[model samples]
Target: MNLSLDYAIEMDQKDPLKSYRDLFHIPKDKFGNDLIYFCGNSLGLQPKTTKSYIEQELKDWAELGVEGHIEAKNPWLPYHEFLTESMAKVVGAKPIEVVTMNTLTANLHFMMVSFYQPNKKRYKIVIESDAFPSDKYAVESQLRHHGYDDKEGLILWKPRKGEELLRYEDLEQIMQDQGNEIALIMIGGVNYYTGQYFDLKRITELGHKHGCKVGFDCAHGGGNVPLNLHNSGADFAIWCSYKYLNSGPGSLSGCFVHERYAYDKNLNRFTGWWSHNKETRFNMRHDFDVLPGAEGWQLSNPPILSLAAIRASLDIFNEAGMDALRDKSIKLTGYFEYLMNGLGDDVVRIITPSNPKERGCQLSIQVKNANKELHDKLTDSGVITDWREPDVIRCAPVPLYNTFQDVYLMVERLKGLL
Candidate 1:
């Protein structure tokens, strides 16, 4: 809880994941000093190794041309495959259950194509009141596409009037009240605005009990926490690599379809050449043999350059290990919480949960009588943080790169701004 610079540096010095901070190219001010970056919840800093990983692909494409599909160091035809194992490992799912394909929203719609099978009797979809806007839009469109009134078909699981965090009991009550009518439950694994990490297994089991299929968008949770998606029993899930996964901006996304659905070819999905069986994918004469598992949802071959970037970042995750990273994250974010609380409730209030287990590295700070102008000031003062609507400032002290000293310095600047 000490706010002294020495205490923060001491904690950073003791951090097992400390060296990871050096792997990223921290943004710098004009004086060449690194900006205290707390924006990983939106976009992760680039890994130093990303350029080389991409260059290798460029080299192969240049030297081998069309032949690079089979002759290159990492073949383009199966470049996406190289990322499967590590990406699955990061999200805690089996290799068979995961695939790196389309971007986040696209993959979400593809998953809904199969999972959001709504009928007249059971057509309602459940989501958090403040689920990421894209998810809300996607589900609403799915409802309308299925010939249901979007507002009538949508059920929002909301927090109490005076609260920001959602309670499992409230969700359970929703299931109880609308269980039979609800066909699907889609939620953000970690709420973007609040940084609340809902218990995925609890939600999935509740949905299953109520005869509803469950899915999650783990864009904020993917590398920030151990999702254990397999154990969660969610029918499907999707996450982007640009944020906590550090794959670069607008990078490809990862999708997870539970093993039970792997061979269920009867499950309807959109298909393209890439989703055809690998053995006959290039045959061009064979019928559209939709591949099993999450791969079946893909519509095209992925951009190799994007996959290359993902491979570069996944390589780092493989080395650091998710468990160890999460371990540091808990401690790191705890330190952040402690320091922010030290800022005094009169000046700042944290909308994100105080319980470490309920959130990731991000803390949504609500400043009393302040606005986005405060965020701009922080940015001008050489600290990078995200400003949400109303009065919240989102700052994520990502464990893989952010340090204790960075947290201390950022908060010290915020105190001055206030």
Candidate 2:
């Protein structure tokens, strides 16, 4: 496979999904050549069609003002409805169970209000040891707010000694040990830093067996991996649209409450005006009747411009189909792994799991004898990858826009720098 650029060129020529690269506007350096973008985990390259979607919403707002709520071709009152069907297919959820609403952290808080019930006896929350900071904070704060001590209420399911990736057995042990005290098991569906995809179904089953509520933070896994949330039996899940979903920064995020709770009025949620029943919403009566399905979780009218960007991205996903997208992703990322592994262990060690099923598009490489200096050098060379402090460098080969040539170019550049 070290057969030079011809191998990469040949792969690109044979890539059936090569046409998708044209759908996104790849970033360029000052010299006017395309920059090798491998940071899709941070932010996805913009879809070329995004402007048109935004323009439609802009025109409606300019012409109709408040009347646009009901006058626009796709009325603002029902704007979010346009997304449900497509979003459901992407995440393997029923339409009634999914809703695109607030930002990721906010949605996490809201989901916790409803699901993370901590009583006097069983009040612990279980999460991965190296969870995203925002997730850690959210769960910790939730614990404190309920008058529970964070140190005691939070149970971390950590990796084995000297191991980077967490195993399902470790989580099972934590649940078995703290089953009576644990109220919830909130995990990152695919670990952000390690790119380790946990077995969702297995975790959910174990949590349920212990009578603990289970949920997933799918921010990294959302569009990058197949999340059969419904079949996985997770009580809830949340994800941001800006990464693999390709929406703009701080775009609207998605929430999935299992169909079992879609109409369960007993589920205690923090409600607002938008959650009120539509028929009585305009009536503004004293009675607070809630809407059926996931729409009930929505607390306010969403920013249509942001949702417009998401719609544009989802259109691309719908055309490509997630299964087809995953197929391309596996091959493209596999090529990246093969090339990186060929670089030898003296300089590089892959922290992400070796099994394709255990990861999405990213590979976290631990650079030996390298600090931020090596990371800085890679950035200076125009290879756009992210660095998490201490040791690892993350590179994500997004199948939608990245080409095989980009991956080859990156490996070649890294080799030269070393």
Candidate 3:
């Protein structure tokens, strides 16, 4: 709760994960000083190891040609598998339930193909009113593809009048009223705008109680929050690596399918040679033998370069461990909140939840009468933040790289502008 610069420096000196900041290549300003990066919720800072990781793949390609598929230091044939266990540990799922493959939206569509089995009476999908634009569009396209009118088939779980956060009670009422008509519940694990982390287990149980399949878009929650996807009992989940996972921009995404579906070969899914059994995959004349579990959802062989970058980042996550990162994240974000609150509510309002368990590292701050110009000022002051439409400026003090000093300095700059 202390606002002094000495307090911030002391916290940084004592932080167990403080050394992690050195592992990333922090972006620099025009004068060559490191910028205060608080945009991890949009795109994470690249790890220093990412360059060498990609270079190794380039070396293999140059030296071995096609033989690199099986001859490289890390074989390209099973490259995605190298990421499974580490990714599962990050999201609190089993190895069989997780796979790294296509981009986030693509994986979401593929998941919907199998899980969104709409019948005559139950043919609707429920989503948050303020979901990320891509998620809303994907669900709408799914409804259209299934021969339903998008407007009629889409149900929005909206916050009450003038409210910024969603209420579980409102969701329960929606289920009580229209659950039977709802075929699936697809929600953001952590809301992008509000930064409200939903109760995954509670949502899954409620959806199940009403005979609906539940899934989550974990783009904002993946590495930033401890999802525990398996125990939540959600049928499926998808997330991008470019955000909190810290892979390069537009890198591969992670997908999760519950273990209960591991052996369900009968489930309908779009597949390709990559999803076939490895033994018979090269036997081009054989019938398709779909691999079990999340791997079965793969549509093609992944780009090895992207996998290499993901592996590099996952190695760091494996070393630091999500539990320790979460502990630091709670303290760091709490410090940021404490400092922001001292700025007075007249000038700033935080839309994100106050409870540490109900949000990740990101805090969505709405500045009174502010516009894009305010965001530009912060950027000029060497603070990298994201500005949403209207008035919110989102800042994430990532535990992997951001420090208490970074948080303290950001507030100081904001006060100057105000």
TM-score of each: 0.99, 0.98, 0.99
RMSD (Cα, Å) of candidate 1?
0.9
Q: Residues 4-83, candidate 1, lDDT per residue (tens digit)?
A: 99998898888888888889999999999999989999999999999999999999999999999999999988888899
Winner on lDDT between 1 and 3 is 3
* Model 1: CA > 4 A from native: none
**Which regions in candidate 2 have their CA more than 4 angstroms from the true location?**
1-3
Top TM-score: which candidate number? 3
The weakest ten consecutive residues by lDDT in model 2 span 1-10
lDDT of 3 at 87: 99
Q: What is the lDDT of residue 176 in candidate 2?
A: 72
Question: Backbone clashes per model, in order?
Answer: 0, 0, 0
> What are the lDDT scores of the predictions, listed in order?
0.92, 0.91, 0.96
- Model 2: lDDT equals 0.91
Error of 3 at 36 (Å): 0.2
lDDT of 3 by residue, 136-255 (tens): 999999999999999999999999999999999999999999999999999999999999999999999999999999999999999999999999999999999999999989999999
Worst 10 residues of 3 by lDDT: 274-283
